[model samples]
Target: MRRLFPALLAVAAALAAAFLLLPLVALFARVSPGTLVVRAGQGAFRDALVVSLKTSLIAHAIVLGVGTPAAYLLATRRFRGRSLLVGVLELPLVLPPAVAGISLLAAFGANGLLGGTLDALGLRIPFTQAAVVLAVVFVASPFYLRAAIAAFEAVDPRLLEASRTLGAGPGRTFARVALPLAAGGLAAGSSLAWARGLGEFGATLMFAGSLRGVTQTLPLAIYAELNVDYPVALAIGALLVLVSVAVLLVIRLVPSWTRFASIWPTASAASSSR
Candidate 1:
């Protein structure tokens, strides 16, 4: 029975892998290199790719700038309502993209809660490039924040204490000790956030209106092309798949690279002492 159970699990795993890979295999099989090249040269494809890259990069910057410190605070501090705060921040991680879009609309749309104030200041958010960036940041920031908090928490408290003992202040200790040790995890989180931002669709389409060259990211472009130009859609989908695979590989490789970097100096020092 035990042997049979293991065999059954292996078969199930293989089936799962095949299920996931088959669609991607078929997609690439249908998209020839010549078709991809032709689509890539089109203005619409170029615009969508450019917008996607630009907005996602901006969103990634926002995530890193804001999420890193916020994560550190969450990791090291134990204040009242901390759990509630974390839950609220992480809500977007599980929230449907459509719901996220609606929430943004309620907050930032014309006649929305803050719309009057924004209008007075001449700052419109909905149906613009900025809205696209906001949607990406809204959905993707949680991934980086959660990962960053875990990474910071994983760092040794002793190291922080030692840095403090050496006359480093809190900020200095965090900068020198915590960040270095947690860098690999941060990199992985950033990659995840970037990938998520790059692929964002529902929220962007709803809040940003899918305006070509303004809010039409790669995913939106794919949707626009699906019925009108199926070949272009397939080509863009293949590009997204390749980018996603590369990001996943980077996420998988970063920790090993960090580990090797940490080990090399110690080994060199040991050899010198010997």
Candidate 2:
């Protein structure tokens, strides 16, 4: 039965792949290659791509910079309500993007709870590029944070001790030791966040108006095209799938950074070695 396990898993995997592939195959089959080309050449598509790339990058930066400290604290320390805090951070991960959109509107919309005060400063968040970034961060950061926390948790504690004994500062130890070891997981998680942010539609549509070059990203463009141009929508749909697959595959290619970590077993290792 142990030897037969591989065959069983293979069959399951094949079925899953087919399920995903069939829809893509059908979508492309319905569109002419020429039409796909024309859709790609359009200004809307280019603009959406640019907006997506820019905001997603900004969102990811915020996640990485903020999430690192949070993850590290969670991994190394514990207190009452730590788990609750983590859960709160992760709530957006499982939330429907549309619901998230509505929530954002309630908080930041023109007539939102704090809208009047913000308006006094001439600040408008909803239906703008900044709103899109907030939505992306809300929906996508949890995905990255969950993975990042796990990665930080997996790091050996002893190495941190050893670094301290050697007079290495906290910043240096994190940069040279902890971070290099967790690089692969970070990369994978970052890519997942980017992918989610890229495909985000519900939140983007609800918070930021799908105003072509203004608020529309690729996914929004596809949603818009679907209403009036089925072929164009189909083409963009196929493009999205292609982009997602390409990104995921690239992330999976990163070799593990665990080897560097394996060399450190404890904080006392540095002193003992000498």
Candidate 3:
């Protein structure tokens, strides 16, 4: 019975892998390496690529700065409505991108929930690069925070106590002890956040609009190309596939990163013993 189950599981996995990868294989097969190079060099493709990279990177920075703290707070403390807060933080992950767009628009639009307040302050947010960043952050940050909270929670409380007993201040202990122990997990989570942000589409389009050289990111351009040009769409799709593969590879590479991060402290402890 056990042997049969293993064999059945293997068959299922193989079927799933084939189902997912066959389309990608066909798409890549359609593009010769030469055509890829040509498209990559074209101004529109290159510009879109640059915009995607910039916005995704900025979104990632925002996540790391904001989500990391939020995760830490969730991990280390218990308080009223903590779980509720976590739910709210992760709500975007479940939202349809178009709904998320409308939600943002209603909250921060020119006449939105907070629009009056923002208008009073003479600050503009919608239909801009900042809006793109906001949309990306909205859809992408939860993936990071969830992973990060798990990571921080896994750190040994004893180690933190030891640092405190040895006269480390709260900030020093966090920087010198907690952060090093958790860096690999944080890196893995951050990479995933970046990947999610990079692939963002509907929200960005609705909130930021598809203004070329202003708000037209690669995903936006890909959507635009699908209506008018198939080859351009294919080319953009190919580039996105490449970047997605790279980021997914990094996410899978976390085990190695954890192994490496574990090595340094072990080495130092061994040296002290010697």
| Each model's lDDT | 0.92, 0.84, 0.86
Regions more than 4 Å wrong, model 2: 1-17, 30-38, 256-274
Instruction: Write the candidate numbers in order of decreasing TM-score.
Output: 1, 3, 2
Candidate 3 stretches with Cα past 4 Å from truth are 1-14, 264-274
Ranking by lDDT: 1, 3, 2
How much does candidate 3 score in TM-score?
Answer: 0.89
Q: Write the number of the candidate with greater lDDT, choosing between 2 and 3.
A: 3
Clashing pairs in 3: none
Residue runs of model 1 more than 4 Å from their true location after superposition:
1-7, 263-274
Better of 1 and 3 by TM-score: 1
Residue lDDT tens for model 1, 124-153: 999999999999999999999999999999
- Considering only N, C-alpha and C atoms within 3 Å, which residue pairs clash in candidate 2? 158-266, 158-267, 162-267
lDDT of 3 by residue, 1-274 (tens): 7699999999999999999999999889877778888987776777788778788888888899988877988988899999999899889889999999999999999989999999899888999888999999999999999989988888888888999999999788888887877787888888888888989999999899888777889888888878787787788888789888998888888758668656446646878999
> What is the lDDT, from 0 to 100, of the residue 148 in candidate 1?
96
